[model samples]
Structures are given as structure tokens and as C-alpha cells.
Target chain A: MTRYTQPTTFYTKEHEWVTVHNDLATVGITHYAENQLGDIVFVELPDVGAEFATGDDMAVVESVKAASDVYAPIAGKVVEVNAVLADKPETVNESPREKGWFCVLEIKDGAEIASLMDEEAYKAFCEGL
Target chain B: MSDPTTENLKRTPLYDVHVEHGAKLVPFAGYEMPVQYPMGVKDEHLWTREQAGLFDVSHMGPCFLSLEDGIGGGDEAHAKIAALVETLVPSDIAGLKEGQARLTVLLNEDGGILDDLIITRPIGEAAQGSLYIVVNGAVKDADWALFERSFQGKAVLTRADDRILFALQGPKAVDVMSDFFPGCEELKFMHHMPFELSGTSCIVSRCGYTGEDGFEVLVKPEAGLPLVKEMLTDERVKPIGLGARDSLRLEAGLCLYGHDMDPTRDPVEADLAWVIQKVRRERADFPGAERILKARAEGPAEKRVGIRPLERAPAREGTMIEVDGQPVGIVTSGGFGPSVDHPVAMGYVRSDLAEPGTKIDLMVRGKARPAEVVSLPFVPHNYKR
Candidate 1:
């Protein structure tokens, strides 16, 4: 099992996780998304400062098997992209929540969290799979 | 998890084991194969390179061809069987040694490839005397048709669908097999050793698509579960999926049948002239031998070459390759090479521009990226001698 430094603070239906720090939410793939993707090769993150409505495509993550679009969990403006992924995309496999953070978004709509799955629900969903 | 393809596709013998181990099963080659298990493709690929990875390739077709006892006796029997097959392929079966296998291409008269296959002379112990063969899964029907129509009375082609095929590939494959079969260490590259794998008689060959020291095991389909279980008991071995298999083979510069060569691409253009033995080339018995040998001597209009994508962006299949702003060829197989830590691909370009180090451009998502035509095998092969 992969060790994550942060608990499941915030998770999207598409299986993205966000660790909240002040107004910035460091977004990365969930344990489920990483496991589903197999091995991540290239990550195409949105440009820094890009704005998106809830559910907009924020990034693209490609695994050896196929490519997937990372959707926004909540309405937000991209503050920073994970430039480190350009060199080490496999970090998402090793440190999914911490070092593999896709981007830091400045939260625009906090209510979007209410619609997202909580830790217990997400764990249950993963179990049901 | 909700794919209709998975519901309809056939499961391999390792299907339950894959599910038990949390493998993400996806449809591949008509079977529900694990794309990856708990460990991801990057980890699985690296582990296979360093250690070993178990692959369920049971979907691949295996068959045996036996020559019938003709009314005209011995030498006539050999002559008639060779003539029938030689008309469809580009190999001299008349010269194949007992128990020796030869990789050959089935070609159309216009010099196009039908499919690639490995044919082995499984004589004596296996049966009266038969030629064992394996071909790509996707084109097995077409290949079988070619055999059935051509070999009518001279030989009988029997498909071994009841058998299961497994590939244990990596630098540590020999070590893993040696732990089970003591004399497996003596099996040289491209050689086969018939052994009892967990009380089931099987054929273990020292050959694999991955450019690594590995073994391809053919066993009874019912024995697949127990065999895979026993093999995976070693910590060095992990179940790998088709995803990693593609990257590993691409890195090794091996061709994927339909992608790299098809009915329109001949062996010379595909750079597979090595499979055509000198005797076969001289005999001129195989189909399209006239066109193939002439192209071998004079070269073809295009040749397959490797491409190194300039950046992180991958060049997928069908991406156009250009040189100096003009279209030259198209990418046949392209992706991020997990083992090499960069994006690499293979495609056919004009013969003049196929040389290594030639700068080229790959049109990716409407943008052109700088690329170079490099010699195949972006990653070195680690085959045992």
C-alpha cells in the first residue's frame, strides 16, 4: 500500500484528492485514481493562474495503459502547476498525495466540497469496487 | 469496472487470481487481461526489468501441423508438405531441424506481410511428427484459414485452444525457472525444453518478445491456475498487464504485428530480412519470394525506424512524421517508454531519411515536435546467450 502524508481531506467523484492549506488546495490523484491508472508516465497540468468552473478539466494524466483527464473537484483558479512532474511523473505512484500534487488551486467555491465524497464514503465506494 | 467488453470477454486461467490480487482487468486480445494489479505499470515494468513479472498470454494462438502419410512414401511426403506451406510463407520448412523453431512471415504475393509466426518442428516425442506453431491472437482466424485451405490433404492443422500460454520475462526469469526445473539453466536463447511443470507436461522456451532473458511456457489450460500460483509465490515475480508488455516490447524495439507490419508492408521494408534464411531466399519457394528477395538486394522505398519524442508529450499511433515541413511517414507505435524515462516510438519513413540521428518532426495534437530517427531498441536487450 502507498503511504500518504495527508488524510483524505477532500476528494472528487472522479477520484482526485485535495489537501487543504489555507485557501490553497494541493490537488493530486486519489489512491483509487493512481491504482486505476496503473503507472503514470506524463502529466499535463493546467497552466498556472488558469481559472476553471467546477468539473472543468484541470490536467491530463497518462498511464502506460491509457490517458485520463483530471477534472476539477471545485470551482477554483489554478495557482501553481506541478512542474516537478515533467521530470518524475512516477512520483505520483510513490508519493501520490504529497510529492505528486498536480496543482495548487485558490478555492473559489467552498460549497463544492459538500457535493464531493467524504473519506468514509470514498472508502466504501473503493471497497464496493 | 463497468465495461461491457469485460462482461463478454473470455477470462484466462489466472482471472480469479488476478481478481484476488486486486488486478484491474481489461479486455485485450479477446480476453479479460489484467492491465495492472495493485502495483502500477511503472513499478511493474521496472520490477520486470530488474526482477521478474508473470504475464498471462493465454490468448495467443497455439497450434500443431502434422504431415499425413501420403500414398507415395517418405521423401514425397516431405516435399508435398513443404510445397503447400511455402506458397503462403517465406521460410524453408524443408530444412528445419527436428525440435528447431524458425520465425517466419506470411506474405501476400505483392510482398505485403500477412502475419508473423514462430514455427517449431515438434517431432518424435510430441506426436508422430508435427510442426508446432504460434501466431498473433488478432489474426489467428486468417492464419488458420491460410493453413486449412492450403494444406488440405497433405497436412492437418489442429488449433491448441485448450492450452494456456504464459510468459515469465525479466533478467531473473532463468533464476525463477531454475528453482522449479533444475536443468532449465541449460536452455539457450530461442531454444525449448519440454518439462513437467507441476506434474503437467509443458514446453518452456527461452524466447520472449521483451528483449530480456525470459521464458514462454505452454501448459495445459487447466494447469494455468496452479502453475501461476506456484510461480508467483517467489517474491521476485509479480503479475504484469498488457500495458507494461507494450512498453517493454517497444523499448526492446520489437514489432507489434498489425501496428508495425501489415498486409501492405513487406519484410524488407519492415527490416525483418534476418528471419528469411539464405537457403529459403535462394530456394525461391515461398510466396512473394521474387519480390522480397529483389527488395532485399535493392532495398525498399521505406524502412522502419525508431523515434525519440523531444519532450514529455507522447506521439501516439497514426501521428504524422515530417521532415523539413513535408510529410514523410506516420507513427505506427508510439508512447512514453516506462523503462527509458522518455517518450519513444517506431514508424516507417522514406528509406533515404531512415538513418539514425536524422532530425524529424512529429505532429502531435496539431503542433509539431522535434524528433530524431534513431536506430531501433531505444533500450538495450538483455537476452541470455
Candidate 2:
């Protein structure tokens, strides 16, 4: 628990977003993800207490076009999930960065998230695509 | 990465129109086409059911097959052309009335379906010996080749895909079409006629992919370009892209060529036994009639049926269908049905399990999702019968 220093938000190359605060993290897909996915119909969440290693396929997001996998940003133990997504999957499209979050995790390593792209870097990364 | 596939893709006559409407272009069946406009897919799909949606379908295969030696006159000439083509298909082409269109499938020697198509005999003495045929876009080359091989010295086959083809679909389509063609509103389902549009004669058919009452118009690009613009200006019509076109057809229980039916499967297996008319069944002279009639009598091992996911999860293509922990079938086409407001799918299940209300489970992402084998057309067809 005492491995790293400051808190920060980061993004993965696969278009997921995460915010770390102390030992806990909040995770969701990015605005780019929602836009690319179009109208989302279902969000299949991982069960509470489910464990995942970095880069593992952690969740599934099914849209009208197709289903896409949301990978784990870092090693983490799932503590909570957004139940609202089951009823209102479009929330992911309406407010992807805020209320449209997927789940919360008890992160294992701060260094894994620290090395990811920042908001500015992610903007540039998406621009290149 | 180098895009070898995108290098040879073709563009439609309405490419500029789609770009002007802020369409997101994607490569489909060797063409650069709009998958959706700025309004997005879901809204585009719903709009077509509630209002008129204009779809550019120029990429599909529309061709004219006529007798090579030229016709003498009247119903005899139409029968002559019809009899020649009936050799390849099981449907009674010779039985088609003037201006009437019938849906049928092209078959291989083993009773496997090569492609599904609509063939319409023209309605006049001048065009008596010619048949207007439309096949799927993806397998068009093979379809044309089949035609060329079968009718080499007997009939002339000409490709009409260069001419712009478009569909106006939805509940408001008849109202929109009437403003252009005076008698379009009165055209019966599965029928067509020649109409004057943009000062040029065009073929207008009261048929569509969406289950709505609509028209499919074929015209030269010069006239088509302006007609599309004029229709968009009207309040009832909007430009719809391929994405909506797909969901609309799926909801309507229409089959996508490569997805639902293929060369390895026969028409009976594809649940298209209705295409074979009774007169032809008795005659039984078409290709693979022996094997096809056998399937019709005894039924195919697997049958295509409608599947509705009881849960929120969508069972996509290639998803396994199971019963009692045993594999029974696989989903052919599945997606979020915007109109139904849930996940809708179609698949081939074993004959015993292909009944309406039959309970099954779809393996989506390795989890069993409860589903039911329901009757097709998740939405009711509103065709003007």
C-alpha cells in the first residue's frame, strides 16, 4: 500500500480511462470509445471481488454495431461496479467521463497506472489514429 | 499498414451526396459506402420505421436478361424468356404475370443456394422478352458468370449497376413517392412500373428491404442525383446509410446474403421453401430438384429461425446455441435491434428445436444467456399488400 507517492488519472492505448486515488481506482471507457462504439445496449460487468491482471479482458461492452472488450488497465481486485449501466447503457454515451463509469477497483500497483498516458498525451495519441 | 483491400474498392454515384450529409464511409463488398450519417445508426434506423429513409443501393446487382434472338411478341415471348431462366432457379418464372416480381434463389447442382434474387418481368409489348433481375452485391460477379455460362448463345445479359439504384422506405414513403410519381401510391406490393422522374423514364418498384411500405427506384445517374437531392429537401425523407439498412432488414426478418444464406446451404435449409411454387414443385425440372424436394418432404437437418435474447446481452454471429449443455446451432446474424429495444437474432437450430417459444441458451462471451426461438420479423411487416 505504501509503494508510490502522488495520485493521477491515466489512459490505456485500447481507449479506457482510469482515476486513481490512494489505493482505490475508478475505471471507465473514454469519450473516443463511446463515439466509436455508437449506441451501447449492454454493459457486462465483472462480479465484485473478481481479480484481474494488467491487460486482461475484464469487461464486455455490447453496442448496436458489435461487442467490444474493455481490458484491465492494471492489476486490480474488483470492489464495486456501476449497476446503473444495466438499465441505462446509453449513459456511457451521454457522459462517458463522469457518470458513465464501469467499475471501481482496489489497484495492486501504483507504478502500472503511473506509466500510462496522461490526459494531454492521450489526446495526442487519439489524434494520431 | 498497407491497405491492399481498400485499394480496389469502388464508389457509388451518390458518394458525393453521402459526403455532403456527413456520412461515415466504410468499405463493404468492394465499395466505399456510408455505414451511417452524422445522426448515427440507432436514430437512423428508428426514423426509417416512423418516416421515410432514402438509401443509396447502387452497389447491388441489377441486370437485364433477354432472349438473344429477339422476341416475336406478347405473352409467348415473356414465357420463352422465363422458361430459359427457370432452368437455374426453382421458382415458376413462367408463371409471373407482366410487371409482377417473385423472390427466388439461384441454386447449385447439389441443391445448395448460390444466391437469393428478385426477378421481374417487364409490363409491355416492347419489353416482353426481357426480365429485370436483382441479385445481392457481394456475390454479383459469380451470379453474372452463372448467367453468362447458362445463356451463352441463347440470351443477352446486361449489367445495370452503373445506373443509380435507391430505396425509399418507411410508413411515410408512399406519401413521399406520390409527390414525384403520380401513380406510385397505387402500385401494389411485389409490382413495378415505368415512371417519369427528372424528365427521364425510370423504373419504380413497390418493394423494399425494410418491412415498411416503400419504393425501390432505378434511374440513370444523371437523373438519380437530382432526385435524391429533391427527396432529401422534402421533410419526410432523410438520407439513411448502410448501418441502418442492416438493422432494418434484420428486424424485418430479411436475410443478408453471406450471413444467412450461402452456397453450402440449400434454400430449404435457409427457410426459403416458400420461394418454390406448387406448380414447379409438381413439375420438378429445375436444378437439384431431387435433393431439394427430398429436403422439402423430410425437412432439413437444421432450420433458420428467429432468436430473441431474454437477457440484455446480444448473441453475435458465430455465437453457439445450446440446449441441456449440448450444442444445437449457431447464430447467423445478431445485434441490438433498435426498434425492438432489445437484442434480436437469427440462427440455424436443429429441426426439433426450431419452433416458436422453444427455450434455448446463447453462449455470449462464454456465458449462457437464456433465449427463445420466436417467429421471424421481430417487427411486423407494413408492406402495402
Candidate 3:
């Protein structure tokens, strides 16, 4: 399994996680988000060449309970998606932060990443919920 | 995140037990019910199918309809009470054997379903003049009002809404129940009998919504928690919630009262004609009999059918269904089937498009997803006779 243990990861209010490395950023849902979804069965990913704005619905994660939209954490162009999720959607429930990353985006504006919540703030936000 | 809509939500008898088990509570049918436990919906669903899962259905209406004094006794009282109830529904209530249950639908004047319920004739001489009825939780108040207006002065309706109703469903359900209450194994499908569990008077019915061999126990409010705790002591049993219950019923092709069929949809159109027995059809004496019988003979315009989306994406309720670019119908209930390991749906469609293998399109997020009409009970039933 692909492992992602980056310390610079940022989180959105919508429960998406972003880990920026150089000019590209990897995006996925947080563990708390996947726990709320409950056993994802399908993942609809955007095309690799598609462009998205921050907060736009970039993908859909459907579970046995309900379907939820995964929003983009930063404005960028999609570079790659986790193709393995097509046959194995449970990866999100198993590992929402690592191998379950939805897609990687070529960063359009670096300053947008700085506006997201840090790990401490994200933990506090989840606790409040 | 505090919403005022949840302020008036009610709690079931097992509310504290659910919270202690780390359940995720959600508002359903005007009650704050647990949607799933820490095991999640899929895992809970699979556990019920493989072993046994206990569900707290206390929110549903469980009541008894008893005849007044001098209403006759023994078989005469049963016949009179059945005749009175037959006026509201299209089931063969009079023909039901003592200790037998039948699945029936309450009808409106226009022949649409008010609610689907399980009505049983109790055993023994003491409860002979009464019928035990269980209705959906969401419409219990409306159902009670209808009964009051329809059968006023004829029968006394006693509401046991505070009593807890738990359904233990799975292949191993009978085994577990037999272990708990000896002789429960003798109860056949659709049969119910009064029994005592740990010195508590309870009723155990050999029936459930899931297509599995199971039993539904109706117990006093105070005995609910202890009964659940005792059942969970067995390795085969676990506490299931509403999320898995929904998916399990969907997989079994059971129609949800409000979502699958309601006051606007009749039983014939819902493909539940078998519920209306042949003798009742000939008599044509119940409410909406004219419209229901006409639809039965000539067939309805649209019919409910099972759907399997070719893609992995789940098509949810209210999704539009089309055929050859023409709108046909809308999905009533759709979701992922944990047992089938695929997505399954049920909806009404033009009679011409209701046949199995007929291709259709499900409009999902502005795209038409390929799907096909298929036979129901996405997963086969395993009822023990």
C-alpha cells in the first residue's frame, strides 16, 4: 500500500486533506469523513486533464448509507487519480489518507494552501462536531 | 451543528444501550434512532445475513384490537373481529388460522396503500377475541386515528407503543432463539405465539422484513434492555441499526411503506397483488376493491420492478429512469447490497419496460447510467418454511 506520512498536510472545513510537495498537491478525504460515509462502494473520479476550482465538487463517494461529494481543497489541474479505486472502493474506508488519495493536482496558486487548517485546528474542528 | 429540527425527536427504549455501544444516531421517522454502530452499515448487514443481528424496532406501533363485552366468544368472536377489519383492507383475515399472521396493506378510498402491516390472530382462549397488529413507526399515529374513526364502538384499540419490538434475523436466528426460549423452534414462518422470557410476558413472531429465518419479540418497556443484553451474550448475535435494516430489506425486495409505496400507489401497481387473497378478490368487499380488482384483471399502467445498474455507482431514491430517451419512471428505493456485493434498486416503470433484461437508463448527476430491469430479492431468501 502507498503510505503518506507527510507533516505538512492541511485540511479543509469540508473534511478534505491536502498534502503539498513542491508544485503538486495530493488530495483525499479525512478519516473522520470516511467514517461518516460508512463503507464506500463506488468512487467517481474526475478526468486527469480536468481543471477544478477550490471548493468545487471534484468527485463523488458513494457508500451503502448515502452518496457524498468530495470537494477540491485547492484550485489546480488534475494530474492523476487512484485508478485502483474503481474495483476496490473500500480503500477509502481502509486508508483514507494514503493509498485512497483521490487525485493529484498541479498547483495553480501556492498561497491557497496556506489558508487551510493545520493538524491541530483540524483535530479541534472534528472534536467540535 | 445543532439543528432545531431534532429538538422534538423521540427516543426508543434501547436509546441508552445504543449510545453505550457507540452508535451514530440520526433522525428517522420522528425518532432519534441509531443508523449504525461502530461496525458500520455494510459489516452489520453482512453479519445479520451470516449469523444473527438484533434490531430495536420499538418505534413501530404494536397494539391489540379487542372486542367489547357480549361480542361472542371463541371462533365466533374471531370471525366478527376479522369481518370488521376486512372493511379496511383487502386481505383474507377471516381465513387466517389461529396463531397465524398475514402481511396486509391498509388502503385509502382510492385504493392506494395507507400502510403495510402484519396482522396476526392470537392463540389461547383468553386472547381469542383480539387481533395483534404491528404498523410502521412513521405512520402509527395516522393508522391509529384511522382505526378509531373506522371501528369506533366495535372494538377497543389498545396501544402498546411503549413496548419494545426486536427482530432477530439471519440463518442462525432460529437456533439462537431456540437457545433463549425453548420451543421457539416449533414456530413456523408467519406464525406467532405468546411466550415468557426470563419471567417477562412477551410475544415472539416467526417473521421478519429481511428474507431470512427470524423472529420478532415484543416485550415490556422495562425488559427491553435486559432482553437485548441477554441476546448479545451469544456469539452469533450483534446489535444492528437502521442503516443495515434499510439495505437488508432492499436486498430482500421488500417495499418500504412510505418510500416504495404510499397513499398514491396501489398494491397492484406495487406488484403486491398476492397479498390480496383470491377469496377477497372474489368478494370485492374491502375499501378500494373496485379499483384494485379492475387493475388486477386488466393490469396497471406502470408496475414496480427490480433494477440493477450496469455501473458500480448506486442510483438513489427519486432518480429518474428513462428508456430510448423517453422518461418512464422514477426509482423508489436504491442502494448498495452488501450481500450481493453490488448495487440494486427498485422502481416503477411502464409495464412494457418492466420485463427482466429490458435495458433502461438511470439519470445520475446529468449522465445516463446503463441499467436493466431484473427479478427482485437481489439476494435469495433463506426462510425456514
Candidate 4:
């Protein structure tokens, strides 16, 4: 059984994954990204009501070694932020694709999903690294 | 000669072991050392705090120093060697007992810190009256030069660059090591003893940087990899790298030589006054001892303190720390502490703002974040005897 993603979800070159069921797409970091990041120490999420264009920097993930920005997969309005991450950032390392989900967005352009890499291509890209 | 920058980067004796364990290798101090392993920095940091972790510190220089002679070389050699070393550091080397170790700073004549080093007097009555020293990797060349020019032919300095040094640290370190070296469990902190491992004679020092019960083993470079593999075969031992080493030390409130300290920082300003012994401070011997003493009495203008950011953002090294509207100091070492589960940083600020609970601001990429000075280590340091 699949744990973190549905067959309909997609991933990005930066290793963020988004699961879309309708107008809303739930976003989180990929397992590969979390592993490379070492331990998730602190996570900065965008404001709940903030609007973003496709590929805009919306969040930040920091590890002991370095910090990286997590970009939005598609243009949308941030509906909810992951409040649990403030106290327990390691959740991203424990379950990067599930409980570690960063934010939910109201997808402004549903067609943007086609712009992202599919599951097969994403897995191959991660393996190449 | 080929361009020095393009020359091959050296590898420590245990470089292959790090690769076999899937460690991320990075260039450090002119050697390719492991930065982290497959378990990653966070797990390695916590596991080392909870259990035992093995570190390949062979890149650091371990050397022996003493007086030399051909015919008349008994008590006279010991006296000369002791006097020569006493000039370089402020430690009471003449009074140090056999097998005892002292942490001392190598100071410049201008009262700036050169580096911090560990000096062991020696062991056994039959051994020669030489001292063993382990110094930082980056400044080993400078340390060698200082000893050479100061002692000249009067004292002999033998470099042990071909040796391997491994640190086994954590609460269970002694238990794990005792399984191999039966007598190691009895060694106290800052103490060392000569022991045999796999039929090879080695020196195991009951000292470490992680604020945990641990031992640093010095062995022949050729035999280092096999020992590391053997130690790691046990479930309790894991391979740690530079990444975790830095984070663990930060969490323990230990100073990293170049990042947290430099020639510009004195022992007093860095809050390492305990290392400046009273003998040196009173007698005012050794380089820069006078300035250090004066700083201690009158107080250092700046002080190092811990900063905890109010937001989930991190204030990294080189970031500006400000008070009210003026810049005070810069963050020296900053990172996410795995044990504390938060971003923690250390830096120097004006003495008046060094008190805990004093509000401050950290400029992270031109954006100001709320911060405050708090007690160091962010997490409690648990050093077992």
C-alpha cells in the first residue's frame, strides 16, 4: 500500500511533492530531499493567506549542514501552513511526504500539474543524484 | 612544481572506511574527510550523545617533543625540554604528573590565540622524558614551526603525521572500548594510558570534545582502518563525520578553533580563562600572558554568548547581530542543533549585552529577526567520568 502519495500526485526538480485531489494541492518535501538534508532542524512556512506564482519560494528547510528554500509547485493561494513544524521540525525527516506536509494551496492554475515531473521521472531524477 | 591548489588532496588513513559506509566526503584542512554518513548528521549527533560514535581524526597532527643528546642525555635533557615547552604555553608542564594531560592554549606574542592543544607528559619510568602533543589540523604547520624555531637543536620534535587518531565518544564509550582494551574503563578524564590493541601498542586518552565519556586512540596509520572496521562491527559503534562533530561540539559549548576562535580572540574574551593557569597569569611568562592577565582583571570589552532566535529561522555564521539600532557583533558558529530541535548560534557581543535574556536582533539576509542572549550549549552537556 502507498503511504505518502496517491497515484495522482507529482514532484518537482527541487524534490518537493504535491498531491492534488481537486482544487487544493497538499505540498511537502520528498523523502530523497529529506535524507539529503540530514536532519530537519527548522522549517519556515509561508503566511497562510500569502499568494504565490508558480515556482515561488514559499518555505525554508534547515539542517545542521545548511538551509534550503522550498518553492511552490504551482501558482496558488496558501490556505493553511504547517503549524506543527515549528515545535517538531524533525517530522520532515521522519515522514517527509505524510505528516511533514508543509502547506495546502488552492491551485490557481490546475494545468500547472502537467508542468511538473511525473512520479517515474521524479524517481529517476533522484536516482541520478 | 605543480600549482599547489591543483595538487592532489590528501586522504586520512580511514578514508576508505568512510567511503565504504557511504559517508559524504569533503575537503577539510587539505584532506578529504567525511562530513556525514548514511545515517546523516542529526542521527549521528544524537546517537553519539546516547551511545558511541567513532571519528577518524587522523588528519590532526600528533607529535613528540624532548631534548636530544649523544653522550650526556639523562636529567639534563628533561630539564631543557620542559623549559622549552613552558615558553610556548602557560601550562605547568614541569609539575604535570606522568600519564596526565593538560589543555593549554598556544598564544602569540601579541596576546592572540594561536591554537588550543592537549599535552601529555609521558608514561612509565622506563620511557624517555618526552611529551606527547595533539594539535589542530589546520594550524599544525604553524605549531611545528613555533616549536622548531624556539627549541632549535636544543629540543627534538618528531612529527607523527603517519599515525591515525580515532575518538570513541558517548556514555557507553568506555563499555565498548573495555571489550577490546580491558583496562581502559578505569582511566579518568584528562588521563591516558598505553595499551595493546590487536597486538599493536597504542595510546588511549580518556578525553574527547563531545562532552561525553570517551577515548582518543592513537595508532599507526596503516593499522587504523582495520581497527575502525573492527570497532564498527559492534552494534553500539557508528561512524561519525565532521558535520556531526561540529554540531555535537556546538551543543556541548565547545569551541571550534578557526570558526569560533582565531588570532584576534583572546582567552578572556572567548570565556576560556580557566585554561590560562594562575602560574602564567601571576608570573606573566609565555607569550601574551600580560595582556591576558590584564583583560582578566579589567574585563574584556567583548564576550561570547549563546543566541536563540525567536522564530524558526536560523542565524548563520557571518550574520550581523544588533542591539537597539547599532551593530554589536557577528555570529561565529550557528546551526540547527539536533538534540535541542532548534536553531542555535554562538557569537561575541559587547559585554553589557552579554547577559542572558538581553534582547537582540539578527540580520539574516537583510531581514531582521528577533533574538536573545541565552546560556550556552542550548542542550545540557552530559560528560561522564
> What does TM-score give for chain A of every model?
0.88, 0.93, 0.93, 0.91
lDDT tens digits, residue span A47-82, model 1: 888998888877888877667888888889998888
> How well does candidate 1 score on lDDT at residue B253?
93
- List model 2 lDDT by residue over B1-385, tens digit each: 2357768899999999999999988889889999999888999999999999999999999999989988548798888899889999999999998899999999999888899999998988888889999998889999999999999998999999999999999999999889888888888999999987668888999999988899999999999898899999999899998889988999999998888988888889899999999999999988889988999999999999999999989899999999999999999999989999999999999999998999999999888999999999999999888
Q: Candidate 2: deviation at residue B153, Å?
A: 0.7
Rank the candidate models, highest TM-score first. 2, 3, 4, 1
Q: Runs in model 1 with CA error above 4 Å?
A: A1-11, A17-27, A49-57, A72-79, A104-129, B70-80, B125-129, B196-200, B222-225
In model 1 chain B, the worst 10-residue window by lDDT is B70-79
Interface RMSD over true interface Cα atoms for each candidate = 1.7, 2.0, 1.2, 5.3
| Residue B264 CA displacement from its true place in model 1, Å | 2.3
- DockQ score of each predicted structure, in the order shown: 0.48, 0.67, 0.73, 0.44
Show the lowest summed lDDT stretch of 10 residues, model 2 chain B. B1-10
Better of 1 and 4 by lDDT: 4
After superposition, the stretches of candidate 2 with alpha carbons farther than 4 Å from their true spots are: A1-7, B1-4
Task: Give per-residue CA lDDT, model 4, range A1-129, as digits (tens).
Answer: 223334378999989998987788899999888987877788888888999998788988988898798988899999998888988988999988889999999888877888888899999887776
| lDDT by residue (tens digit), candidate 4, B1-385 | 1346525788888878888999888878888889999888888999999999999898897998866652134444455566778888877776677788988888888778899999987776545468889999999999999989988877778998778899999988999999878888888889899887667788999988887789999998656667778899999999999999988888788888997889999988988888867766677887888788888899899988899988878888899999876999989989877788777899999999999999999998677899999987777756544
lDDT score, residue A85, model 4?
96
Candidate 3 pairs with clashing backbones:
none
For residue B232, what is the lDDT in candidate 1?
A: 89
